[model samples]
Target: MADGLARVREQIAAASARVGRTPEDVRLIAACKTFDADTVREAIGCEQMVFGENYVQEAKVKWPDLKDEYPHTELHLIGPLQTNKAREAVALFDAIHSLDRHSLAKALSRQCENQERHPVMFVQVNTGEERQKSGVLPGEADDFIAACRNLYGLNVAGLMCIPPAGQPPEQHFDLLAKIAARNGLSELSMGMSSDYATAVAYGATNVRVGSAIFGNRFYPPAGQ
Candidate 1:
């Protein structure tokens, strides 16, 4: 794991240099979804302070307990969030990278109003137009971002996207960068394990990596 992390870090540095940018310009968010606490702790030991999770329930189980052991780590909720879970998410996460609609934004805002701190959020754009994905369609990106910006208690930090699997990732990432540029937004969260290098070259501010860093995910038996 240590060797893998070192290699990944070197890759990130090299990719950043290739684009004429510094490594500091990109944030590598270790995606910890489906991994156990001990593995996550190992990642923390490697000085990886930013982590991304897909399931709210799983994160709730890991974050608080791990916080005492890894106090400096920042948790980002990068999953499809349910409106009913908004309050818990706002309370526990440092950021929500999948804010896809006005109602979800409003719910998060309301929850933040009572919380000690509000989480930074990004509007997830469905750049590949996947029917099963949770994101605002590309054409609706501007309106959705505008709506989020108008909401109270929510800091509209940037944008996030997951391009269709198996396709060349550069095309999707490039489109995302263009959209963000046109809207005057500075942040882009558009990379994952497989195509993160391509993402870096195309201007991804945050890359959410899981298997590339943690190895293959282990799922429990059918009934758990």
Candidate 2:
């Protein structure tokens, strides 16, 4: 874990340098999906304070006690979020990167109002329009982002995307950067264990990296 964390830090610096951006310009979220609390503690030992999780249930099982123990840590929900779990998600996450639809926006708004927990959000964009993915298609991204901000009253921090696998991610990253530019958003939550360097080169402000930092997730849902 220490070696993996070191490598990612080095890579992040190198990637940022390639684009003439400082490493401080990019925030690293240690995607800890399927990783145990002990591993997370190990990451904290390595000075990783931000983390991303795929499931609310799993975060619930892990973060409550962990957060109490490590009060400075921040958690981001980087996977599909169910509308029914909005309140639970509100209570658990410090940030959410899956605001892809109007229904979710509505549910989250109501929950934020009720709970007064305004977790910063990113409207996930499906740059490749993959049916199996959970993000707004590129064409609808603008309208969805507008509604999420103007109507639903959610805090639209930026955009997020999972570019097509085995394909060059530069175009998709560019699309996301353009969308963020149009929306006047400063954050771009893209990239992962693979291709994050390209993501950084394309101006990603927050990169969600899991396997590269935490080693491989041995259970279901595998990587983040």
Candidate 3:
């Protein structure tokens, strides 16, 4: 884990230098989906403080104890979030990277009010316009972002996106950066293990890297 993370940090520094940005300008979110506490702890021992998890239930299982042990670490929800689980998500996540719809916004707004644990929110934009993806379509992003801030009162701090597979991601990254620029948002949570360097060139403030840092993941049986 130490060697892998060190390699990724080196890449991040190189990428940032190419664009005249320092390594401190980009935050690395160690995507820790499917990895267990031991693997994640190995990362923490390497001083990797920020992490991203996909499932709320899975995070619930792993993070509470981990957070107890390392109170300074921050956790982010980087996958689609269910409205029914908004309360728990608000309490557990330090940031949420999947605020795409109005109903989910309403649920999160209420939870933030009830719990007073307002997590930093990121509006996911479907830059590739993929039907199966869970993001606000690019055309509707401006209005949606406005409503999240004005109507729902959520702290919409940044934007996130996942370009369509097998396509050039630079255009999508550029689009996300433009949207963020016009909206006055500074954070852009795009890129992954594959294209983080390119994303840094496009002004990504955060990159979610998993496989490149943690290596290939092993999942349990389909129906455990």
lDDT of each: 0.87, 0.93, 0.96
Candidates arranged by TM-score, highest first: 3, 2, 1
On the 0 to 100 scale, the lDDT of residue 30 in model 1 is: 91
As a whole number from 0 to 100, the lDDT of residue 36 in candidate 2 is 90
- Model 3: lowest-lDDT 10 consecutive positions: 215-224
Tens-digit lDDT string for candidate 2 (125-212): 9999999999999999889988988899999899999998888999999999998999899999999999888899999999999988
175-212: candidate 3 lDDT, tens digit per residue: 99999999999999999999999999999999999999
RMSD of each: 1.2, 2.4, 0.7
Tell me each candidate's TM-score: 0.96, 0.96, 0.99
lDDT of 1 by residue, 35-72 (tens): 88998888888888899999899998988989887778
- Residue 214 miss distance in model 1 (angstroms): 1.0
Error of 1 at 200 (Å): 0.3
TM-score of decoy 3: 0.99
lDDT of 1: 0.87
Worst 10 residues of 2 by lDDT: 215-224
